[model samples]
Target: MRPREHASQIPPTRSASIETVLVVTMDHLPGYEIREVLGQVVSSQARTRNVYREGVKSLRGGAYDPAAPENLTRWRTDAVARLGEEARRLGANAVLGMRFEHREVGEMWMEVCAYGTAVVAYRSPAAPAPDQPLVAAETAHPAEPIDSGAIAEAPSAPNLRTAGETPTRPD
Candidate 1:
């Protein structure tokens, strides 16, 4: 199979081309979750009066403080963008099994990782063609290795849902 190419070569199709696989380290951060943890720490330090205030300030000032949710959000966003760019370069229209890894370095440095498999995807083919087309059929088959030019002709699948149809729930 040929290596992936940047999105420029293949014009973006109307079909999603995007795949379903995605992964995240932290699923959701409800306000209550953050509040509860902070509340407990605050209450515990209340016994020492102003000590908690200093602790909070110090935490905020720390180079790798967890209090900075915005930094984490930005990191995540950039990582995803990088991953997407990599996928695009590989001629993959979608990424699957996406995941992130976080590592703390010493007292100040932290590293965040985002990774996934890049894939060239098209909507599922309808009825099979009687004879193989000019491009190799294996190129369109997910299990088979990819073929650059062969992928260009793969037909996109039709959307099953109508305008009024409700989306089906996952089992």
Candidate 2:
């Protein structure tokens, strides 16, 4: 049997491609379980407006166009596309906790960065079964829940400050 080819080489069908490389701002995705915790993936691009486009805009009395750099839709699309490419390189199917940021490099140039944690996610297989507490048929009250020590212990540390003294690290 032959192994499957890379997903990028073969374009995904519409419905399948919609979820192929998800980029979500949320830390967790609904109905999808993260199977692996891949490391960070980042992509960035810097761009300046085309001289011809700027000339056209100036000729039009500086009127706003949907594609202007200030509007940034094009730059964002390019950056996110690059980000998805990086995630795919990592063998990740989705990117979680994704974020976008921009910085001005000069009077005319700006840079945009897209970053997130790459992860492999699978659709949740089954609806969770609601757990029912075992109880006596004749009991009028619910049984007390046992303490499972789920709460984490606080780390041991010295006091933040001593009385009549500024808070400082010990010598």
Candidate 3:
């Protein structure tokens, strides 16, 4: 078969759009500092099976797979996208502590929910150089210089019997 023409020209769907709002499971973003907590943002989507069709499929040995990976992924993506939209509306640049919950209503309906705390965040200032300590040298108390002679004259460990030698009991 000939190669498909203009395959790249098609615009991506809304669900597949570039994520503008950052969503992270961590309580805080590594390189970003949170400025304001907008509040909790939540999005839920529910899907129902066609009872008649599913019944027939099951009878014919082609049972519907509700827990299919693709279905679950799509559900999660859609829920998260909705959550991001809500966060954007709240003037948040990122969502922290994101969580996903799935619930089934009997055998017919499935619901996927995404929730997180929305916050305004900005990229944190660049970190100090590896060689530089977190605390300033001027404010910190200077470490005293070590005396090699003192260390050499320091008390040694207590005398003990060597291997295979029996220890004497104290009276």
Candidate 4:
């Protein structure tokens, strides 16, 4: 009998376009994010922490213990993957100001929330301004704050298109 060829034997083409941006926000997950996306599956499981030498040392009166390193790593990886999946769903290429929040639910239960703003970012045409040295004012007198009315407001995009024309679209 002739040997059967499998689809996995074929390599992906180099011409394939790849998404350059990735945005992620996660809470907690059991399985890997990539696995979930590819396999279209997701699972959640509660994890427990084990006390260790470091955790014990850091605690006062030997009241605290360390958590399992393996479980911690796995949970973190899954959370990150879930966040990335969320960003991908939102059509965001990158995430900014990512932050995590931890909360204790019960005696042994802890919750972790990973969050950030996801956006599609592209390189700007102009270069950023150079850094400048700070200059202290010699006078101790306070300067008057600028009035809001004195500043010019940016023209709205909708108004720009109209340019003095009567409103064609209903409110």
Candidate 5:
């Protein structure tokens, strides 16, 4: 039987269409305020592996290549893109705490899943102009100074003894 050609290799030049939605692994985006939480979003992709090719390659004493088409990185990227698209469809501008998961189905199939919390966020307004210096309120109660004499002394360290030995008075 003729070996099947490797398919589903993501072209290096093609964009994943992830530009519309912002994705972050953190729960909150710095400098941006979340206006609304739109709930969780997820995407999944499953691919079949050519076990014959892999078995033949292993028999030939060839080590698996990390960059080969069999690697799940490409699928993971696609999953993230789909996740972003889902977020966009839900009217969310961003996905926070983005995460990826991988699973194997029996022996020939594998799946990649991506998930995150969708949210609508906007850039936070700039800090108030430097002209208005922040000041403490005059009516606020002041903290009282600590008095050294009023504090109780720290307890002395306990004497440690060996497993079966009794404490002996000093000679």
Candidate 6:
């Protein structure tokens, strides 16, 4: 039998659709504040081995191209898309503290679950003018002086080496 054609070797599309839900592993967006909590959302997909493919793989014996499958890339794309759908359904524009879990189902199937807290995050309002002082001039705390004590009160320990010296291990 002829070998199966390889899936396109091009990089997989990594982004979701036009809505562009911000799904991330971090709990907080760096420049945005979470305006509303929309609760948790999740999605999953199952993958099973194809017996015909496995037979071909076994027959090829030691010919496995470790990186050929790119299964994670495919799975991640699917999971993220599904997660984005779920988040949108919950009226959330972003998923925060996102994480994934994987498990082997019985012997032949694998399942991946993606989950996170859904929330609406918006950029916080600009701050008040920088030079405006909040406190009265008389009550401002005074700066304290720094005092560095004298050095070399105790004898210097031995084996301090110069830049060119190789260090020796202690016996």
Candidate that scores best on TM-score: 5
Each model's total of backbone clashes: 3, 0, 0, 5, 0, 0
Candidate 4 accuracy as TM-score:
0.39
Best by lDDT: 3
> Please, what are the lDDT tens digits per residue for candidate 2 over residues 20-134?
5777899997777777878999998887757787788889999887576545876777777787777777777778999999998876777999999988777776654347443
Please give the range of 10 consecutive residues that has the lowest summed lDDT in model 4: 1-10
Please give, for residues 99-163, the per-residue lDDT of candidate 1 as tens digits.
Answer: 76777655545677777655544343354545745454455565766656543445453344663
Per-residue lDDT tens digits of candidate 5, residues 1-171? 100111111111134475557778999877777877889999988878778767877897987755556467678778888987888788777789999998988788888899999877766777545476532221122254444555322234233455346566889
Candidate 6, residue 53: Cα displacement in angstroms equals: 2.4
Let me know the TM-score candidate 2 reaches against the reference structure: 0.57
What is the number of residue pairs that collide in model 6? 0
As for lDDT, the candidate ahead, 2 or 3, is: 3
Instruction: Please provide, for model 4 over 1-171, each residue's C-alpha lDDT reduced to its tens digit, 9 standing for 90 to 100.
Output: 110121122222221221333433342221212212211212233444444553666666765344455656667555555554555455544445556556656655656555666544443434323464222221222264434555333333245656778656778
Error of 1 at 27 (Å): 16
Candidate 4 or 1, higher lDDT:
1
**lDDT of candidates 1 onward, in order:** 0.45, 0.68, 0.70, 0.42, 0.69, 0.66
Off by over 4 Å in 4: 1-20, 23-46, 49-74, 126-171
Evaluate model 1: give its TM-score: 0.39
Tell me the TM-score of each prediction against the true structure. Answer: 0.39, 0.57, 0.60, 0.39, 0.61, 0.59
- Model 3 scores a TM of 0.60
lDDT of 6 by residue, 1-171 (tens): 100111121112346351446788999876667777889999899988666666777899946755436886678678878887787676677788889998989767888889999877666566434575433221232243223442222133344557358566879
Task: Put down candidate 3 lDDT per residue, 1-171, tens digits, no spaces.
Answer: 111221122222355331457777899777666777989999998888668867778897996665577878888998888987887777776779999999997899998999999877766678755587644332342364445454222234333456346466779
